[model samples]
Target: MPRPKRPGEAQDVGAFPPAEAGITVVDWIDERTSLSPGIRWMLFRKVPKGINWAYTLGSATLFAFLAQAVTGVFLAMYYRPDAAGGAYESIRYITDDAFLGQFVRGMHKWGASVMIILIFLHMARVFFYGAYKYPRELTWIIGVVLLILTLVMGFTGYLLPFDQRAYWATIVGVNINGTGPFVGPFLSDFLRAGPEFGATTLSRFYAIHMLLVPGAIGALIGAHLYLVSKLGITAPPWLKAEPEPELLEHSEV
Candidate 1:
């Protein structure tokens, strides 16, 4: 498929005019995988007539999640899950010594709260707008699952610093979880540990926080988005339903 280059020809293969370059690249990829249509359908599809800022809550919540994920990755670089003072010292070092570590940690710290707030707001919007009806019920259920997982993510991550507050908070939280009927005692025992035995507890929380829960949340989010896209958006409840013109009878035809 190679054409012999003639003398004086430019060697740059993608040196098309700037205006066409983006389209050309897109076309190349689209031809190979037929990916463009799916993307366009997912992103640019029609919405109900009452679409407004409220409809954007899902996107806002998604942005907050992305922010948390990015900052969390950076924080993970300096975080230590050691319960033998190493964990607290690592956090102290980040807060006081590492370059911009405090800022990243702060973002992750505050961003968790922000994400929780946004998801709730998004849930409220869906509920009030009546977007959870019919075929969309599964999407709403998946969203509820995501909300629970997000809370678990926050709870598990809160224990990673191995601070006194985190330690006590986790103990209380585990006690709360341990109230589940059959598995209650086992779960409580799994999470509750003495100061000398806290290493295993810290490790378990760290793994669940950074690996298991996040992975589950990510997968559920994917399913939620897919369902949303497939089911499409519903009109806000305040919007009056209009009779279709096709259904109107003409006086004279």
Candidate 2:
């Protein structure tokens, strides 16, 4: 007969420690999807020397987005898009009734402001660092689009409470959008879902806030990150670039 295993030993041959089991699961999925190499390529990058903390502003902005997404989902569980009275009451319920409702709502609220700030700071970093040139120009454009979408998300989310201030503020916002020259009036009308904030206006904005804009933002973020990983990061602006071959030869001569 085989000897009995010790107490510390695994009871079965298939048994694995948590770390080993995690690796096994990852390997299994990677084998099926052929994703390991892609993941390694994206994550395990060989970057230029002298990379500074300022470069991390992009990552900070990304995390801010993630935080917003999480907190937004939590808020969505309790939010109602009713424009009449249900919307404001739902918000009141979240603030006064639901478990940790106020806390999560606060996160989603204040987090929007934080996300906007982070993205601007990130854009500034990219601009001042001279990383917005040539190969990275598309990335810069995408970032600009994301910035606009973020602003839209903030705008749409602001009206969810359906309070007196929100109602009037949104009216003011739509009017301002109407002043966008030729297309401005049409665009604002579309947003208000007609000539005025009709029955479906809040619902429309809610769908946009929770679904449309977030989906677009996620897709763009994926593309942005892929470009960043593939093209690699630029060195700090103060750092000298490699000299051209002709210049090197001329200098040697």
Candidate 3:
């Protein structure tokens, strides 16, 4: 007969059995790479108190971007970027034939809009709360650059379908770029791959959308996160007048 649990005795559920295994793997990698310290610093760092729901916008924006990146990669697998009439048809095939392609494509499309809105909201929150002042100026600047890159990502992706709407919108966009000052003509020429949109333009947009913009955004995100970790999240204005002690220790004097 099996022994029953006694009073006040705890039942073992075999929870966390893999915890030791996970630690072993982490230690093995940490030994080779010396990554534990950095990881701990990043994960265990403290931030300002009294942060409210507005603080979540930045993380939400990051999540939207990551989702867009994943969905974009899946989309690229079947997307044909040729300027010839195939681009629209390729999109149709993906939406109609590929498994779950419609859902992924829809997510990528809507995710871009969500990311843009969230980023704007985040910037507004920071600006209104005065987080852009003082020691966080560089962070704000990087965030602005990130915002610009994100907009450019949207613009570039807009033309990938190569439909009438995309063609006309890109034409208008190129013309608008040409209206700028010193580098305007050069910029327009580069974007159109000559005087007007063609196969080269499609290729260029694809390269920018899929490679250059994402790479730039990724680098800026890394820098942004590093600064956030180092500077700590800004305290809400209504909080205590004095900054946190740890924040003062890390701030520029």
Residues 204-253 of candidate 3 have per-residue lDDT tens digits of 99999999999999999999989989898888888878777999999997
**What is the C-alpha local distance difference test score of each model?**
0.86, 0.91, 0.91
Clashes of each: 0, 0, 0
TM-score of 2: 0.89
Tell me how many residue pairs clash in candidate 3.
0
Off by over 4 Å in 1: 1-15, 18-22, 192-197, 250-253
Which ranges of candidate 2 are over 4 A from the true structure? 1-19, 242-253
* Model 1, span 1-253: residue lDDT tens: 3366789986666644687778879899899999978888899988889789988889898888889889888888999888878999999999999999999999999989999999999999998888899989999999999999999998998888788899988888887887899988787777655433355889888888888888898898889888888889998888898877776665343
- TM-score, ranked from best to worst: 2, 1, 3
What are the runs in model 3 whose C-alpha is more than 4 Å off?
1-19, 242-253
Q: How far does residue 7 in candidate 3 sit from its true spot (Å)?
A: 44
Error of 3 at 23 (Å): 2.5
Give the higher-lDDT candidate: 1 or 3. 3
**Alpha-carbon deviation at 66 in model 2, angstroms:** 1.0
